[model samples]
Target: MQFIDLKAQYDQIERDVNERIHAVLQHGQYINGPEVRELENRLAEFVGTAHCIGAASGTGALLMAMMALGISAGDEVITSPFSFVATAETIALLGAVPVFVDIEPDTCNIDPGLIEAAITDKTKAIMAVSLFGQCADFDAINAVARRHGLPVIEDAAQSFGATYKGNPSCGLSTIGCTSFFPSKPLGCYGDGGACFTSDEILATRMREIREHGQDRRYHHPRLGINGRLDSIQAAVLLAKLPLFPHEIEKRRTIGRQYTEALAHDRIIPPVVRPHNTSVYAQLTIRVDDRDALQEALKQQDIPTAVYYPVSLHHQPVFLRPDAHLPVSDEVAAHVLSLPMHPYLSDEQIRRVTTAVLEAV
Candidate 1:
């Protein structure tokens, strides 16, 4: 079976997607075309945020947010160790230190209780990653950020379609960044991303940051990168946005089925927060013998992946000599991701769950 059945999803929306692409091609405004603004507007409405700025990739979105916040050398950004490298990579790329806190063993998200201890005078922002498409406890994290007078950036790359209480994922913090990589829940055909914010100043800053720090054509105001999303990708996302809500519901339904099917197994299913809905971006689970389980699942023709095999603290490039996160270390060793997508059928889910249960 396919890990993420993008082909099946395309089969349903091919006509609309093709029409949108044709329009973009005819207009020839490949850079900042009308479709790019249209997508930004649609995403802003969906995220319940005042503004959204298109980016080249999720990493670009995070980089722009850091720049907008004025994070500089000797600055520190508190974040979870247990996430995709982009979460911490963006911080380090800005000449700032990524102060990683341990994760909650269940959700694999940054443990908010441990965040305060990691902060210091150098702490510029609290970057909380929404791992496995479920948002971290933003209320608790935001309370801590408020007490410390620090801004919070929600790394909503995986949780774009998710909701925390009644608020959307990208609207839960001072700045929200999400990826539109092909594998993400609200993905486009290629690399694309966005930054969401209610603050007009920050929004304006990000818009400039995405375009080489230009206030207007050739008016360079500050250092920035070529991070704008292309019009073709914007067209693809615009076409997909209409069906995103239904797809999110389908993922939840499949997640429930996977949970029920493996209820009696030794493997541990995902623990979604009471106030949040996951988009099941990875459908990760824990097992005692993850390596063996992965091999066995392969034998059963069920594709499995490892979302994160190493903690940020343990990465050779971004190594920290002093800090040690036990939960991040432990979870990294055991986590495995099953094939997940809205297009997955009941029979496909049963096949996946059955293989995983037997393997574990």
Candidate 2:
């Protein structure tokens, strides 16, 4: 009955989780510990990347990636406006502008066809956010970037375990960033993140940036921040990583059930592309009257949520006065997320589908 039932997931792996934490406690190397490196290695191999740099948080990972690329004031990063604030926040934090792009209404991912028009001399990168665990069109996006000789960064925070055209989400772009927030598809016990890259030079730069621009012990090279993942979180992630593949399959199964059951309802279920696999971070659906639908489901003791009610371009802090993104704006107002998790049973899914059908 809960949204993203982490408690039930924890119950399934409590013994292993407890042992991992115990090992971390016994080692007492909370900062830059052995477990941290091990987790980074495992993550790199899993994502099919040459290097994985551990970070304190997903936001920090994005910031470091941008920094490593030399993005600075007066530069612009082309990105979609229908994602988490962190997608745009990192750009603005560097005194750079976030050039807004509209998303496809079907997938709520950035529309690559519109990307070319946004590029300019100041355009430093293309940050494509994989919203709701589905990847953006990396092939098309990368094509555009290649034409313009620009680097692309994939915000794979929601779609960590997902696949886009047989390639892993986090390994599809010039630099991929993912979060280990407890609610993400692949998560740790606390805030953690990683940046993945095949370019060894960029990887080396990011690694140095994660440690206050250190080339060696206490030797500063450039401006950077403290963005290393702590040991305890790494241990938790190591314990959780083994269960991710099966959990992703379960999530897909549940997503399929929701789509099938709601095919004829008032709501429009998520649309995943043929070659893509979504991890279903949030099984979001759309309706004309989202608030009313949510209330109706609530009356039946069914929990629901909205992924994002406000588009990033409309955020008061980073408002774009000349912005006009109709599809993203409409999606922001209509999208609603249902209770979705790998732990959801058939009975639980049936209860949710019944309430939704009746409500809509």
Candidate 3:
């Protein structure tokens, strides 16, 4: 079975997608079109944020947030080592050091308890990732940030539809950034992403940052990048927005089914927080012999993927011999993501689950 059934999802929305694309083509406003603003407004309302700034990609969103926050050389952004490299890469790209933190073994999200110890005079902000579609403990992380008078950037790339304490993922921190990559919970047809915030100034700054720091056309006030999301992508996302709530429910249902079916197996299903609901961006599990299990599943014609095979601290590019993150390292060696998406059929899920159980 496919790891993520994008084909199935596209089939469901084909007519709408085609219509939206046609409209964009007819308008010929490829850059900063009305559709872009429409998408931004819809996303802001969906996430309960005051503003949403569409960006080129999730990485662009993160980079724009950092630009707006003025993260620069000598500044330190504390983040987990277990997340996709983009989480740490964006910080390093800005000449800021990404101070590594361990993750909670169950959630695979940054450990808030380990954050304070890593904070120092240069600590400017906390970049907390919402891993595996479950938000990190924002309450704890925010508390720590508040004590230090630092802003918190929630990397909601994998948890856009997720919730924490009844609040949405992108609305949990000072600035929340999410991806619309095809595999994300609320994906567009292609690369797209957004940044959310309640503060008007920060929102304005982010908008400018996304457009090469232009206050007005041709007016450059600060250094920035070409991070604006294309109008066509915005149109596609707008078409997909109406179906997001239903998709979230379907994903949750599928996740529950997988958990129930695999509970007794040798592999461990993903853990959900008491006050949260994961959108199941990737219904990942921990296995004793991960590589062997993956091979066995492959032999059965079931596809599985490793979210990360190496911790950021262990990666050659960011390797720091002095840094140690045991939890992240352990998770890196054991976690495996199975087929996940709202469109996954019952038969498909059962087949994949059976293959996993048999492999174990």
lDDT of 1 by residue, 1-360 (tens): 899999999998999999999999999999999999999998999989999999999999999999999998999999988888898889989999999899998999999999999889999999999989899999999999999999999999999999999789999999999999999999998899999999999999999988899999999898899999999999999999888999999999988888778786578899887888999999988888999999998888888899899888889988887877898899999999999999998888888887776666
- Local accuracy of candidate 3 as per-residue lDDT tens digits, 54-145: 99999999999999999999899999998899999999999999999999989999999999999999999999999999999999999999
lDDT of model 3, residue 192 = 90
Write down the lDDT of every candidate, Cα atoms only.
Answer: 0.92, 0.93, 0.92
Worst 10 residues of 2 by lDDT: 259-268
Residue 200, candidate 1: C-alpha displacement in angstroms: 0.3
Superior by lDDT: candidate 1 or candidate 2: 2
Q: Which residue pairs come into collision in candidate 2?
A: none
Candidate 3 residue-wise lDDT at 193: 93
RMSD values, in order shown: 0.9, 0.8, 0.9
Q: Write down the worst ten-residue block by lDDT for model 3.
A: 260-269
RMSD of 2: 0.8
Q: Give each model a TM-score.
A: 0.99, 0.99, 0.98
